[model samples]
Target: MQIALTGKLAKAMGVELEPVNDEQNPLFTWTANWTTVWDNRRAEDLLVLVNHATRFTVAVYQVKRKDLKGMPEMIKQAIANTLLYMNINPEIVEEYMSLCGDVTFTRNSNRKAAAWVTRAGLDTSVYIGHEYNGIAKMFRDTVGASINYGLVNYSGKFDDGFMPYEKMVTALTELTGKQAYKYRAFELMVTLDLDVYQAERRIIVPAGLEFTRLHEVLQSVFGWRNYHLYDFTFFDEKSERTTVLTEPLDEYWPGDEEIVLIEGRVLADFMPEHGTMVYTYDLGDNWEHEIELLRVIENYDQESPYLLEASGQTPPEDVGGVGGFVEFREIMLNPDHPDYETMKEWARFWSPELQDWEMRPRAIRV
Candidate 1:
C-alpha cells in the first residue's frame, strides 16, 4: 500500500517517492505544513492523514517541526488502529504493501478530508504554536460523541461521502474471522407499490451500506431528483413493533412510535430481522414502495451499487399522486389526444426523452 506524502514532508524527511502505477494499492496519504498558530510565527507544524479508499481522515497530528522523527511511528500506529476499527487484521494489510507513493501536492487529493475535518469541528480551537492547540484532544472526544450522535450524517454527494464508523465495524469482520465465508451483498427487489403502474427494479448493494446510502441508490434507480423528504418503515411480525428510519431533520414531527435517523444505521442492522420494508417518498404525493430482501450474495466483490434488472419506467416527480399519474399515463399513451403535446412537454422536466422512456441500469452509480 502506498503512503502518499506531501512534497515538503518528503524533503524534510529525505525520503523519495516512487512513480504512480496502475497496480499499486493506495492505503493512505499524509499532508503536512509548518505554519504560524495564533500569535506565534511558524512555531508548530500540522500533519493530516487520510484513508484512500474511504476518503476519511484517519488521524491528525500537531507538533514542533523538530519532532518529525516520531511522525512515522505515529502514522503507523494510526494505520493499525484504523484497521482494527474496521475489523481488518493489520497483519493481513501489511502482507502485500509497499511504502510511499508520488508526493501528492495537488489540491484535489486532500480537499475532501480538509473539508470534513473543518465540518467536524476539529479546526475551530486555536492556540499559540509553542503551546497546546488541543486538536488531538478535540478530535478524539468529538469523534466519540459524534459516533453515537449520528456518525455518518452526510448531506452531500455520494462520491464525497465518508465511511461511517458503524459501517466499517462489520465490513472487514469476515476477513479476520475463522469462517471461510467472504463479504456479502444484498439482492433487493424494490417495487413502486402504486395502483396506477407496475414499476420495479432489482439492485445489489454492499450489505454494510447505511440506509442513507441505500436511499441514494433508490433515488438513482427511480429517476428521482430527491427534492423531498423520505422514510423507511419496518414491521416485525413476532414483536408486532413498527420502526421508522428517516433522514436527520431539524425538527421531527410528533409521533407515538420511536423515530430512528438513518445516518448511522447500516442495512445489515434490519436485514436479518426483517425481510421487507416500506419506503415512502414525498409525503405530499405519498409514493410508497416495497423493498424485499431477495437473498444474500456470498463472496461478493462489487463495491458500488449495481442494477441487475428493471421493469417499467418511474413516473415523473410531482405528476400528482397515483390518480394524477394514471391520468398522465393515459394522456401519454394516446399521442393523438389533445393533451399529448402538453403532457409530453411537462414530463420533459424529469427527462428530456419522455416519449421514448427506457431504464438505464448503468446510470445508477450510487
Candidate 2:
C-alpha cells in the first residue's frame, strides 16, 4: 500500500493520506468524502476508528499498511475494493474513481470531498429507545411514523406518510411533547429450558437487582411464594410433550433425543425496538407451582438472571430438549443517512455483530 498525490490540493487542507490494500479492498485508499475521511478515521496513514465507529470497519477491505509514495493509487484501490464489496458494478466504481483524478477540477468541494457523512438527521439525534421516546411516540401517533430529535447538524425535518423524517417535528409541536433518555439496569434472560412445556417458564430479571423491589414484583406477578422447585412441560403445536420442564439439557434421554420446538411472540411496550418474546408451554404438575414463578419471571426483567451465550448454536433435532434452539435471523437494512454514506458503510460492518449479540427485551409494566 502506498500514496502518491500528483496535485497539491489535498495537502493544502492539512488532509492526511494513506495507502490501503487487502483482500476486500485491493486498492490503496477508499473513495469517500473529506468530512467522512476526517470524522471516521484518524488523519494518519494507518487511520483507525475508535469507539462505536469501529463497528463500521466491516465495509472496508483489509488494506496493506504501507507508505504514502503511492497514496493516491492505494486510496483508489481501497475505494475500488469497497465498491466491489458493496456489489456495485466495476464500471460504476471506475467512473467514480475517474472523477477523483479530474484535472479540470480546482474547487474545494471537489478536492475536500472525502466520503459521505449523513446530514439528514443533522439537527436531530435519532433515539432508538424510550429515552427520547415521548417526542417519537407523539410523532408516531400523530404522523404514524418514527420521529427524530437532537440532530447535531440539522434544522430541517423530513416528513413521509410512513415515518418521514422531515415532518416529525411539526407533528410533535402540534401534540405538545418533550422527551429525554434515562439509562436503567440491563435485563438478563436466563433461559434454562425451551418454553414448550405447560409448566415451562422463562424468567427475566435485572442483572444486579435480583433481591430488591424487583424481587418482590417477581413474587407478586406469578403469585408464588418461591420458585426454587417446580415441574413444567414443553409441547409442540400439536400439544404433544416434546420436552419436560426439568433442565436446559436432556439428561434422562439418550444421546439422540429430539426436543419438540415451539415458537413464541415477543412484545415490548415503549421500547419495542428491544427484542422480546411471549412463549407458552405446558404446566404439567408444576403448573400450579409455576404461576408464582411466572410472576417473578415476568416482573423482574431488570433483575432477571439470563444471558444469551452461544447464538446460532443448536442441538440436533433428534436430541429431545436440546433441539429447542431459536435463532431469529432477520436481515435488517443498512442504509446510508442522507449524505452520511460514511455511517452507512459503518453500519454494514457492525449490524451483523449487534444482531448476533442480544439479551431479551425489557418487560415494561404495560
Candidate 3:
C-alpha cells in the first residue's frame, strides 16, 4: 500500500506528492490526504482519499468535529461536490436523505451500509466519518444494499479509532451473528454427566434455537439415536426460581406451577448468563445433561448447533442410566470374567473399538 497526495488541496495541506501512473496502479494501496477538495475547506477538519487496489475504486472520507457548530454552508457545498463526484442520481439521493433524516452512524450502521452496497452490485464500499450514517442508511433502507464492513472497520466508540485492517478482515470472514439476524446467539456449554462413567460432551448452540432443535443437536453430538423424550429445567441462582420447559407427555406430568412448553420457548428467554439447567432425556434410562450458558454473543452468525469439544465416549442408549452404564463398561473391560466375552461382543457390536477408551478432549464441528 502506498500513500500519495494529489490536487491543489494536497499542496495546501503540506502533503508530499507521489508519482501518478498513466492508469491508476492496479495493486497500489494508497491514502491521499486532500482535506475537503470540495468547495467547503476547513483548515481544522481532515479529509482522506482511499484507493482500493484489487477493486480499483476510489472513495473520499471527511472527518470533522462531532458537532459542525456553524458549518452549514460548508456541509451543503461538500454534499453537492460529493453527489457530483459519485455521479449518483439526485432524485434517488433526495428520497434517501428525506427518509433517513439526520441518523447517527454506529458500527452496526456501517455493517448495514456494507450489506446495502454489496446488494447494489457495487464492488466497493466506503466509510465517511462526518455524519455519513444518514447517507449510508439511505442506501441501506431504500435499496437493500448489503453494507460491506470489510472495506473499512470503525469501532464506533469515541475512544477507539478504526479497527486494525487485519482484524477487521478476520472479523468479516467469521460467523459473527445469528443466521436469522433477528435473534442474538449464545455460546452454551452443555455437558453430560454419566456419573461413574466419567463421560462428557461440550456443545454450543444459538440462544434463539428451540429446545427441541437443541435436543436433536445434542443427539447428534453424543451419537444418540433420538429414541426418547427430553426436558430442560433452568435454575436461576440469584432469583432462586426454576422454569421447566419441556415436551408435553401424555403419560405423566410433573404438576409444577410453571411448566412451559419447550416447543415455543427459546433458550435466551430463561437461560441466564452462567446459570445452570438440567436436561434429562429418556425417562426410562434417565440420561441427564447439565447445561450452562457460558456467554451470550450478540450478532453471532452460527446457523446450526455444533460440537465444540468432547471428552470420553457417550454411553449407549437404553443402558439403564449411569449405574447400569458403569456396570456394563466394567464387565466389558474384565476379560477374565465368564460374562466378559458376551458383554464384549455386545459392546463391540455397538462401538467396534472397545479397547481404545482414552478420555481426551477432542474438538468436533458437528
Which of the numbered candidates is closest to the native, going by highest lDDT?
Answer: 1
Better of 1 and 3 by TM-score: 1
Top candidate, metric TM-score: 1
- Model 1: runs farther than 4 Å from truth? 1-182, 250-257, 349-364
lDDT of each prediction vs. the true structure? 0.58, 0.28, 0.47
lDDT tens readout by residue for model 3, 265-344: 76777756537788888978887788777777665543335455666677777878888887887776677888888876
**TM-score for model 2?**
0.23
- Score every model by TM-score: 0.56, 0.23, 0.46
Query: After superposition, which runs of candidate 3 have C-alpha atoms over 4 Å from their true positions?
Result: 1-183, 238-240, 252-256, 352-366
The candidate with the higher TM-score, 1 or 2, is 1
